[model samples]
Target: MVCMKDPTVQTICEIYEKLSKLDNLSPSKNVDTLFTQLVNTCIPPYPIDVTKLCTQIQIIRTKLIRLCGHAEGLLEKHYSTILGSFDTPLDHLYIFPYYSNYLKLARLEFDLLTQHCQNPTRFAFIGSGPLPLTSIVLASNHLTSATFHNYDIDGSANSMATKLVQSDTDLSNRMVFHTNDIMNVPGSVLKDYDVVFLAALVGMEIEEKMNVVEHLAENMAPGAILMLRSAHGARAFLYPVVEPRDLRGFEVLSVYHPTDEVINSVVIARKCPIPTVSSIDHQGFVTQMTCSKCAEIQVFNHQIEELAMEEHIC
Candidate 1:
């Protein structure tokens, strides 16, 4: 049967054209059958382009749908087993859309942050969940030097991330997976990151959140960007939370919530040098001073009259 020309058909045809070039053809038969079924199922009164519809169906069937199925299967088989051991059901603990939104916002933020950097940069993702958005972003483009370090508290999540990274050659060399707590991410291991991502960790206690932030602030080099997203308001209250206080060395450039249900905020902080303090001696009392101008605290000694005099003059 000849399919009539239509936008749907046109889209299908475009997708088919692209699929024809893929070297992997093992799934072609299944894809073809799925495509045909989708085209046939479309409500019909108007003329439809079967070929074009089939093409578009193939693209969706082969790429997005298939990947989604794979991801779901992986979660059920791997993630479910691990989650079942815990007291809470997997669904209760995880807010899927929250993570999904995080991925979307992270990509947009990363693009904005790295617009000026040269091709093939490195990034570190703290509290990296089952799906590492950073790996996806790096895989989206052909970056020769792009590398990702995904750190998470869950062994299962890290394993899943490793599998995802290794499955794609483009991501294999560029991604590294670590099963580590965000709060305990070693200082030596954290440095020179173009982008550092923190997502969904808002459910964690406020002290833990601040600890993670402090670690990032202290370890990250100058000009590094921190991308974060979390549930705010009542949702945030689910965990023993701490409001973000002023981070001594970092400046908050912007704060925003992308959606009403999700209190997702992004704080892009630039690192400033930590001022050093010289010891002061005054009347056998000692005090250390960070800086007189910044009001940074320091120790001072009463014995050093000269240093005290200098401190007073400043």
Candidate 2:
């Protein structure tokens, strides 16, 4: 637990209090000011035992996410209205102050994805909020030929996001929006995608984040690439962290923690093609074998017979 006497903790609490009451209206200068301060306050070299303060940190994280969501919504609405009056909406995308950030982040993800997938044709972006800037940036600047499927649970956010690109013919033809939870997406549909990106705020809690990762691992096509946003060091206070060990059905490829202004770390992994289970029987005998060339599996109990019932496992 974080001690109240800690100066950093006190400053963080004060900043959170101020941010909680900050105006969420468009042009949220005050909110941005406080958030900048919070970012500076959350710089690395945190006190020892930061893991013990997960609960407290999560409380602050939830508030921060809410604040960001509101600010994003306002900004999206403001831009959408302006774009509606223009002939080419995408031409003005750079007007957003943080547009370059999304551009850099998208380029980083693109470079990482290209390292493993030679020709990725389909991409599913989970938790794409009202702006869907990452998807827009990737579609507009990089991976121009790929089809993007943007998913968000909020109908209003989806409605707003659609407006941002509806007038742009290139994006409208390539970008698709769905208002549904990722868990509700069927495996049949998921199998069509070559890459899937999980947004940082999709699962704010560690358990929830792991559950989503496991779901993707279980449903995504074998050999499909899964990219997720994670945080390292003090950034964990703002976003949930995903350890490589937490990836059960996929083989982690790389974990990149940016020391620069980029907030979220990037994790890229590939779904294992085969399922091979190795478990010790009740009699203390160890059974281990690969189902096939690409199959890898892990049996929790002594259920050896169940392996034959399932065809292709991830």
List model 2 lDDT by residue over 1-314, tens digit each: 66556677677778878767754546657766876787787755454344665576657756665565566567766766676566766778887767787876787777667767888999999998777889998998888999999999988888878887988888999999999999989899999999999998887777888888878877899999999998776666566777777788787787766555667778888888875468898899998643221222211121331242232121
lDDT of every predicted structure (CA atoms):
0.49, 0.75
* Number of the top-ranking candidate, with TM-score as the measure: 2
Total clashing residue pairs per candidate? 28, 8
User: Candidate 1 on 1-314: residue-level lDDT in tens?
Assistant: 32325454444444445544555433346544543433333322234322233454434433433332333334333443444445443233253323454445544455435433445277777766666654555445434466788777778867655655454566667788888776676656676676677754432444556767777776777656565653332222111222234444454444433332223334444554453345658676666442112222222222442354455446
The runs of at least 3 residues in candidate 2 whose Cα sits more than 4 Å from the true structure, single-residue gaps closed, are 22-27, 43-49, 54-78, 276-280, 283-314
TM per candidate = 0.51, 0.81
Query: Which candidate achieves the best lDDT against the true structure?
Result: 2
